[model samples]
Target: SRFAYVRDFELPDRLLPGTFILLRIDGHAFKQFTDAHRFAKPNDPRGLELMDHAAISLMREFPDIILGFGQSDEYSFLFRKSAALYNRRQSKITSILSTFFTASYVMHWKTYFPDTPLRYVPSFDARVVLYPGIREVRDYFSWRQTDTHVNNLYNTAFWALIHQGGQSKKDAHESLRVRFAWPLL
Candidate 1:
């Protein structure tokens, strides 16, 4: 029954009625998004225009999502379901399964964003949680953490994320140079 790993803390309840998706875009893209916002004059309409441009770009590729991007060294998404989505379970994954994913995101974000941390939300605050989905993720994490073998898969996964996830492959790989791989499965 356990299909995925989830953080033990807070998460959204009820899968978003519309398809919910999470994005992990390059850090540079996130920076551009924020920089444009910061440079905008106080209450400038250009700020909104900039946002509109960015949103259009993101949606041209990921059409159907109705929410804004949530960035913290990476991108996350929350949107209502649209019929055109290919991943029907995306809503469930982000609102619920994403708890575990955030542990990874927050950990990575901390390497740089220690000054500002991502807040953990409780499941009670979720808008549309169902009992069965909760049981599924809990079971998955239980089995994963309890596994007798410590393959250090988590560590490897993190390294891979940074190494392969960046725009400059060399720069991204450099991020791992001083760091030793320590898988804490």
Candidate 2:
């Protein structure tokens, strides 16, 4: 029982009460994973479906998660302000959600990619952010949605230039750069 004193060394990570909690989980090094798996460019329906399935599973497991938004290799789960899950422990909430989501993804991978074999395990990293009110939450999700749209548009144009127009990768990038005059990812 003497060793129990070490628990005092653990830092406090309790989230603020009466504030919305958002947990965002993002794929770790998914570019390499996608390349190794030969996921379709621009958009992979199977991959998206797998993510959606995993999110749904997470929601079912944690009913306190009121909303989920996902795009590409990332997902955000919002918990109600009054939720008492884990007593609002930040580490517990983030770790559990990310781990559960990852497990669900792996568990259901075969269903989505029936013909393909998983070469390696995939991982996701998660962080918890608190919003003071509904306005901040709305703005946060709005930003994510806009980011998805912009990135999707860029990817579609870039891939089309290379795959359809037969332009080299460098040429396609240069074309988009010169035409858009905006920084690309």
Candidate 3:
């Protein structure tokens, strides 16, 4: 019962104008990862279980939103936050911490596997060095987070969706300018 599969996936039409634009900062060069190893296989017993855990965690944190979740050696997600309660300032604080934690996790991998081209896992929209043991732990934690779902901090799906429409960093800046300009107008 570690993992279950949903055979079909359908996107609601409203989201066409707004999808969680997904991107991944894969940690392929990290020391602890390699392409040769496996707990079982891709979509095999353990991998599937891990994916299930991650999905549940993301879903629980943003119950009303649709998350485009995927994982390979690394993980990625996207969500819409139009209805979220948190504002830009508080959200910014969490984003900084989230980056720190994610970076720490990736760097720690170097102590495990020394060499491999794990820079990307296009098939799964993932990017990391696949280590069975690490993945098992990661999956377990992901599942645990679901049972103990937090409030705004882990609602990454919502953040991703709000960020998707911008064309570049500059576009993002321009968008914010317009948003703030709205009240004045």
Of the candidates shown, which would achieve the greatest lDDT relative to the real structure? 2
lDDT of 1 by residue, 1-185 (tens): 36345554445343344333333332334334445334321122433343334444555544454444422233333344343343445354434433433334333544444444434321111222222343543553444444422323333444456555643546544655645424532
Instruction: Tell me the whole-model lDDT of each prediction, alpha carbons only.
Output: 0.39, 0.92, 0.37
Candidate 1 TM-score versus the reference: 0.23
Using all chains and alpha carbons, the TM-scores for the candidates as numbered come to 0.23, 0.93, 0.30
Sort the candidates on lDDT, descending order.
2, 1, 3
RMSD of each: 18.3, 2.2, 21.3
Give Cα distance to truth, residue 152, candidate 2, Å: 0.4
Q: Which candidate, 1 or 3, would have the higher TM-score against the true structure?
A: 3
**What's the CA error at residue 177 for candidate 2, in Å?**
1.1
lDDT of 2 by residue, 37-152 (tens): 99999789999999999999999999999999999999999999898899998889988889999999999999999999999989998999999999999999988988887878
Model 3 residue 97 CA deviation in Å: 9.4
Instruction: List model 3 lDDT by residue over 1-185, tens digit each.
Output: 43344423532222222222232333344223333433332223343344445455544654433443344444444334342323323333234323543444444433432343335432222322122344444564464344324312222323343455535555444544523323222
* Residue 140 CA displacement from its true place in model 2, Å: 0.5
Which regions in candidate 1 have their CA more than 4 angstroms from the true location? 1-41, 66-185
Give the range of the ten consecutive residues with the poorest summed lDDT in model 1. 122-131
Error of 1 at 174 (Å): 52
> Model 3's lDDT to the true fold?
0.37
Candidate 3 has its poorest 10 consecutive residues by lDDT at: 122-131
